[model samples]
Target: MPDVLQQRAGVSVLVCDVAGPPVATTETALDLIGNASFGGAEVVALPAGRLDPSFFTLGTRFAGEVMQKFVNYRLRLVVVGDISAHLAASGALRALVAESNRHDHVWFVPDLAALDARLAASR
Candidate 1:
């Protein structure tokens, strides 16, 4: 899959389609943010595969640190694609997704269609 920057619901977004844990640290997150900012993207949609598995591990600070970079830059982030298997293994991650979805900065969704809907609704 190819990574691309796109516009959805009048919002600029960078959609990453790379396979397997592409983003694992704050630096990686910042890199994405920088690219998105340069492209005038207010939101960045990353495939689940691009994220390290440890990101879903609640005990680790990986998710928080990575997400913090987005928040600090005021960029909206969407972790796109399915994460049912991960959620099933950890109640904390499930809760986190539920709560994060209630806000505008970060979101976890099941697919591209769902992400499009979310962007639409926000507008």
Candidate 2:
């Protein structure tokens, strides 16, 4: 399936396919932001599996770079899927996720349902 544009809690969202290309660099992040913009989406829901392994490692700064790109573009980002394994391996990442969840710019959810609930609550 291709990436789909959807509406959740009245918010426009671009739900990326799980089988889509991995987001491993800032360029790819820009591509996603551009896609979201072109699709008239305010948010991008990316499956966690599409993220590079280094994104979970704070030392690499990959996550920060990619997330910053989304933030700079004024688009929200939701990373959906199980990331327990990644969280268990990095304390910094755990803190980052916790902090990010507290904001409106970036979020990490277990599934699309969770993302829906979050979007509803934010509304």
Candidate 3:
């Protein structure tokens, strides 16, 4: 129902629907993470189909601001869905994925099932 930012299964997940303007503040992001954390879900899933284009720019500095919320909260964030369409349009997106995956806190998964696999593996 809302974005979440809290501990789940020993890891913090930030569940969010790709609706509304991308959360602009750490407070809002954490609020979302807190709201959606349930059943010990350690990974958050942001559905791709609902992402607001106006807020997500391929090469923009938005990454830092957006990422800061999760990183600051010490949470792991997974944006899960068919991201190929988005990746296909920009090399920057592909690079972003690569770079994000290199980190311990952020992930770009192809789908929720894959995310589940990742979550399981992390344990």
Which candidate achieves the best lDDT against the true structure?
Answer: 2
Q: How well is each residue in 5-123 modelled by candidate 1, as lDDT tens digits? A: 78788888888876633897888788789988998888889988889899999799899888888999999889988899999999999999999999998999888899999889988
Candidate order by TM-score, decreasing, is: 2, 1, 3
lDDT of 2 by residue, 38-109 (tens): 999999999999999999999999999999999999999999999999999989999999999999999999
Higher-scoring candidate on lDDT, 1 or 3: 1
Q: What stretches of model 3 exceed 4 Å from their correct place?
A: 1-30, 34-42, 54-56
TM-score-superior candidate, 1 or 3? 1
Candidate lDDT (C-alpha), each: 0.87, 0.95, 0.63
Candidate 2 lDDT at 22 equals 93
Angstrom error of the Cα, residue 15, model 2: value is 0.4
* TM-score of every candidate: 0.94, 0.98, 0.67
TM-score (C-alpha) between model 2 and the true structure: 0.98
Model 3 global lDDT (CA atoms, 0 to 1): 0.63
